[model samples]
Target: MTIVFISDDAQALACGADAVAAAFEKAGCTVERVSSWGMFWLEPLVEIGGLGYGPVRVEDVEGILTRHAELVSASTPHPSSSATIEAWTLERQSPTVKQVQGDDLCVGSLEHHPFIARQQRHSFARAGKTRPLSLVDYTATGGWTGLDRARSMAPADVVAEVTASGLRGRGGAGFPAGIKWKTVLEAKGTTKYIVCNADEGDSATFADRMMMEGDPFHLLEGMAIAAHAVGAGEGYVYVRSEYPHAIAKLNAAIALAAEKLAPFRVEVRVGAGAYVCGEETSLLNSIEGKRAEVRAKPPLPALEGLFGCPTVVNNVLTLAAIPHIMAEGGASRYAELGMGRSKGTMPIQLAGNIKHGGLFETAFGITLNELIHDIGGGTASGRPVKAVQVGGPLGAYIHPDQFDLPFDYEAYSVADALIGHGGITVFDDSADMGAMARFAFEFCAAESCGKCTPCRIGSTRGVELIDRILGSGKTAPDSVEALPQMHNARKAGRSRDEEFQLLEDLCETMQFGSLCALGGFTPYPVRSALKHWPEDFGQAGSAQ
Candidate 1:
């Protein structure tokens, strides 16, 4: 009998899965360590093939192994297929066991479980099913077949398929992926590069971490396909240093895949934790061992990037989707799945104060209401659902009335919001929109690379101004107010309406004058909050 136990996943490790794996091996059974299923509440999971029994400890391993041995003592190649063990059988457990199950050998099949089955997984198809760094295991589960097929087609054809599929960058901007590829392919540079932006610093977002840890080979194949199409000889995956497990898995996957796929080598680079580095130009600067600051456009990364050469910079999920696009023989299979220009599936992260929080991938047309009410099961607090920040901290705090908004890029942009990185952070009714908006300014202030004055200075001023507005009990006046008579508004003091107008001016400066999305997008959340949750931001005539 073989016992499978979780080896990676920080939460699983903390739950003492290593001890359980050790116990199973000591009891004279073959044990394999696999990546986590990523479900937090039910972890330290032990599996007899796909049949799972979890939240178990070191002490429970021996009994489970004993039960498995009793159920199928013979050398069965697959423990899950053993008729003696049986499936779909339910039974009650003793009071001392603290749970109920058919046997210690069987809990239930994870394949049909709601947590796994509820998702329309495509890019995340083999998340918990395959080994994180094993090339052989990755291939057995339909991994590199797309690269094998991409190897035969012309570079233009691959770009054509991506363009036709309506695939866009999942790293927030929602720019067309095929268009970017075409630009890079046509750009004049012999030393072009392929870069994967894995510097994910957004709150409530861990899809990139999950992909790198659970399905590394998928990301590798995606990068390799990009390299082949662009005629690039080198690639870099700039992972965040905070993700030690992801970095280790990516390095291992790179070492193995480099051997089979020669001429195209991928190197893993770690960044100093800076949110601005998630931007492409800043990421390039970090790779060059320079200060991580946003760069000016007009020389898009496609035309002149790393080392001043043409480059293709893509998000982890965007590149991860390449294998699927190529395997399905062009974008037709994936293109039909989404709505309007926002084609194909997006891996939405259901997080923050929400029930059943995890990754849910689906087409772009799904309403936020479905994600919040149905998939998320509303707030974890059991209170009425309030606002939802669809992108990240920079995204708007969408009220419940606007819950019908679709998860499309254009749709969100039209609503004064953004679907940046596809990270959905839910908030319950108790949440204060004013506080959330203020945090956006504070985050921008702390994370600004300081290269652009609008982002660096304006963000700090915005935070200070919001504090005054909230403290002074202000609201927008009937007309724009004049600037404060003197500096240090706290001492000199302006009218509530004047301070409110000052905030609007600061937001405008950040939005129009900033060099990158870090500054340009900060106003989205700020303005949205002031517009929708006026009552929460302290009101006019309410002198505190």
Candidate 2:
């Protein structure tokens, strides 16, 4: 009888082991259940004779064994039914493994795919390939190189190396990572903390999720480096609850890392599904067990955070890229890859109604058109492209006219948009620009956290005004003229004219007075829709 082992955190270890033993007993084979494979997507993944089989649903175990002839021949079943065993074998030729170097056996290895392979992968090299809980695998791939290098260097040198890389925060803000690290290192504090903001609430972004699932050790290594560099003894990863698999893997990786790496220790904290937690300060407040609300800046997390201690809060990708910067050629090597004011490879996530939905890491300066058409393969609906939302919920909606724009922070800023979290959500020709604009306000209204008046009240007003515009009939001829005049006014420059002044007033309040990006950037989608698709907001009375 063949003995198989499976490791899943959700199931008790002893229970899983007994279940496997019972399955083997029933199959007339020996059973040895160890632990779950790190890949949560393939839970109950069973390993026998160096081969992995899954997703191994509870009810299908008997049929799986019988169908694969495991009871008699001991041959492994194919990874998927769509592909034959021969095809699966061929696919595993360059299989992506995390740490231990072996024949790639998994079909989902990012190393072999063009979408993941073309650009640099300093941080994510070992993600899917390595056993997340194995420090031996992590150390084998030069995992602690950054920590070791950091232990010897002055704090300033560590900061300098990071600065040289030109690494920016992968979070929506796009701030310089090195500068933030330096601030934490320079801050006067007996106790400092390194926090990884893994609350990826953006519906269209999954780079962080993929990184955690594929290469969790890199994240650990990055966190360790930050802890060591800043002399912080403790760190926390505030992962969102939506990512149960990511949270589980990260927790396992953290426990494994703690056992293996002695000097630096990290912990994983789970967040309730609060979109506001994606904000840095809100994340900190959530970590402190408070309502997730945006705090006023000037006392950024760098200076005071998490129980009033000096904290270095960075996005998952930003920290993951650190070890690569230190190990390979330092920051300059990374900085050399991108366009002006935007350096290093950006892991752009193509989600929503796109044919190819996944992460694409490219140097800045790639055009939006290329990202949407060439890499993304256009809309999933197979219809003509209408608009794309760059960034996340708070980002702007850009029409095809803006597709020629280069994808750098400065370039996007010039076009009055911010690339928050590098999410590009494609919309086909059937998309309603007016409805999307309304959604921007609605999202802000739902997630504002009620911290500031402008965000708390203005978003609701924006939605109501949009509804008024959409609901207004011929009785309000002034409203019809006001729509065009309002669109033109925003183009001409900010104005206080009475006709369409309500929306302009709402935009101004949300832009300037809102506490965070949620409120501050609602106008991006609102104004973009008004500018690009003015016809969508034409009088409802006239339209069919």
Listed in order, each prediction's TM-score against the native is 0.87, 0.77
RMSD of 1: 5.9
Question: Please, what are the lDDT tens digits per residue for candidate 2 over residues 1-544?
Answer: 3444455334323234346446656777545433332233344555433345555555556765654353223222333332122333343342322111223232233234445456565555553344555565567767788777776787788888888888888897889988888888888898999999999998688788777765677788888888877878889999999888789889877777785445667888999988889889999999999999888888978889878888999999899888888774667778888899799888887877887665677788999888888877888789999988898877888989889999899999999888988988888999888788888889888888998999999988788777766654222335444676566433322221332467877898889988888888888888877777777876333221
* Native-to-model Cα distance after best TM-score fit, residue 262 in candidate 1, in Å: 1.0
Best by TM-score: 1
Cand. 1 Cα-lDDT: 0.80
lDDT for 37 in candidate 1 is 65
lDDT of 2: 0.72
Per residue, candidate 1 scores C-alpha lDDT tens digits across 1-544 of: 4546455665566788778777777876666556666565556777664556777877787776666555434332234433221231221111212222345445555665666767778898875555577666677778888898888999998888888888999999989999999999999878999999999999988889889988888998889899988889999999998899889888887787787667898899998889889999999999999999788897899998998999999999999999999996547889888888899999998889888677788888899888888877888899988788878878888889998988888898888888998888888989898898899999999999999899999998888788877784343322234345534234436787787778888889999999999998899889888887777778643322
